[model samples]
Target: MKNLFFSREKIVQTFETLQGLIDGIRADGKIKNEEVIALKSWVKAHNYLEMRRPFNDIINIVKTAVSDHVLSEDEILDIKYVCKKFLDTYGGSKMGHLHGFASGIASDGELNEVEWKSLAKWIHTYDYLRGSWPYDEINALVHKHRSTLDLSSEEKEIIIYYFNDFCGLNKNSSLTHPLNEPNKPITGICAVCPDIEVYERTFCLTGESKKYSRDEITDKIFECGGIYKNDMSNLIDYLVVCSEGSPMWIYSCYGRKVEKAIAMRKAGHPIQIIHEFDLLDALEDAA
Candidate 1:
């Protein structure tokens, strides 16, 4: 508490102020309570000078929300993106730990970036986690960055904290591929994405497919900096396909058939691929 650069009371105040603005957005449109809370938490962690960009953009969103402006998912993500940039610049230690924890959550269960970020921030900042985490005298357990999803809290703390000791800081730990009934099933998602790298070797098929919900696919594209869209004209770089079953449908364009559909519409090809893939999944499967 000594020499505090930012106080908890002020942060909570900011959330309250933004909540009123967001209420206006919700009045015009259906802004979920969860999303509103996430936005407030993102704003609460930082000072105004550092948060201007996200805050201003959020204010605009509020104004737009009041008018029922067409807010795309990417635009909503921008709020989190800007907040992330702000946190990176301002230094988020517990936030950083939550960042890592969020990764594990995604590994075990399905979560969008927004949901993941929200979960991490909430777990780290809420009275439950902040007041409860045993920050002192970390027990040592060498985990080699192994997954602790199944471990009890005591076991997890021992594994993770000791993991820090074993691997040292800056260690890139690998996830454990466990075989068990309760474990995550094989959910492979094939994505035919555009070459999104800003450097050389651009415009090629991206590998490392996701396996789970479409949300996972979107998170992948977001990580790669690829934009997800509804059609060929906007499908700038990549065409993605994801499913919990059948990678073999790939030849028939299983998940990727949409791109082929758009191409077919332009060049004249078969259009049966749409029935095989879920249209709703394609739309929501983004960062």
Candidate 2:
């Protein structure tokens, strides 16, 4: 009793799977289509072949599958916003492709401004790979929408094609960046470099912290511009040498200069030094 292409069942199922990926379920039910087929084999081989399918694929599938899923112009825009959050929390790949795909339909009047902007925002989130290859296909879809909408600065930012083919991301848009941006910088108020939020990194640092959640290990790395190699290796930027819950590794954050010095002294490293925070006088706001 759901609908045609997509049943009420499929819609519910789609969003649920998206949530599972976000929660790190580590199971097979979360995948669909060829991804499901390929994942079945991988799961049997390792029972832990974490999903790598692009999030854009899922949205496209859902859109095509739902027979009654006709979207109004505003609805198209709304869906695009949801797609960003879904992909951010759930993970994705080839975001620019999704944008180009949408642009083609919306530009040609097969879709509307809402759809065009939605696809554009998703694709625009890309820092690189915008308006390249398939993008021409997307661009050729409709110049009318491109010229007629008078999109806001933020909406326009999504399609500016800046940095050459690298034009993605509506610099003016306030939406959070997609998770797929490989070099997307971390944003938060962490005073010290945050640890990597990945499972492996969290596992490595968990048992040591009494008050910490396992998720915060890699989160610290994200805060501090650190790396996340799959397995534990010296490739790590810092050891985070722990002294009974006190961090042993000294971080060089913008404002923690004095604390670093004190920490060094406590660890018995010779020469008193100031914490980065204390040394940075001009950074009073940070203090």
Candidate 3:
């Protein structure tokens, strides 16, 4: 029984990774050689899970598809089908299901009125997911569009961009189809142009920064009269996530600190997960 439990836990974790990889690969709408290598590497890394049902089937499909070092459109579709099947059968957790559902809704590269209504209903049904990193944010965005009789092209673009980021899709994805304007704020970021109060708020940093070193960031926080902690805690008012090299996970970025911050936020902690650029802007304003 203990071994069975352990195996199940491992399977869930691995399955989540597999799902992320698939989303990232398909994000651009075309699989590249590097992506094929990544898929092959993922299969090889998680070979132990092959003894299971969907994993076994998934592994076989990936192996066969990549064996020729070329991923035809049809082959990619087959892999996505299997992954979707696995998601339907064993959709690990509510969060996982939310991610999968959002991906499915945006699969056609557009979110129609029907799909938006369906997604809104799903979000409403999962009231327990409220206050969570994405659930609350997504809920707000959905209702915002639903109330409007007609959405502008930019508004529609916002919906697509938000989901693409949430689903771990590359910003450069064909689906994003960047508009000729200033960069849109990342929807996943808790605060867009936040009024940063550094005087007394506690801050925590996660991921690497391209502009500043760890010590420099901590120094800046101190200089701005903010407290900097290396770890996340309830005391943390602002969790400044470095934009550089931060990989997007299903709910948050790829870090335990991020996961903890999201969990804490869901539990009623007023923790704001801001981007490094936000911090820089705050520092500049203070100066």
lDDT for each of the candidates?
0.33, 0.31, 0.64
Q: Output the TM-score of candidate 3.
A: 0.43
Expressed as tens digits, the lDDT of each residue in 5-112 for candidate 2 is: 544433343443333222111121122232222222222432221232233444443343332433233433444556456656645445333433432222221223
RMSD of candidates 1 onward, in order: 19.7, 19.2, 11.5
Where in model 1 is the C-alpha error above 4 Å?
Answer: 1-57, 62-71, 95-287
Alpha-carbon runs more than 4 Å astray in model 3: 1-10, 13-54, 58-91, 147-149, 171-234, 237-287
Best by lDDT: 3
The 10 consecutive residues of candidate 2 with the worst lDDT sum are 22-31
| Superposition error at 220 for model 2 (Å) | 52
Superposed by TM-score, candidate 3 places the C-alpha of residue 267 at a distance from the truth, in angstroms, of 15
Q: Which pairs clash in model 3? A: none
Q: Which prediction has more favorable lDDT, 2 or 3?
A: 3
State the lDDT at 148 in candidate 2: 28
Give the C-alpha miss distance for residue 180 in model 3, angstroms. 9.6
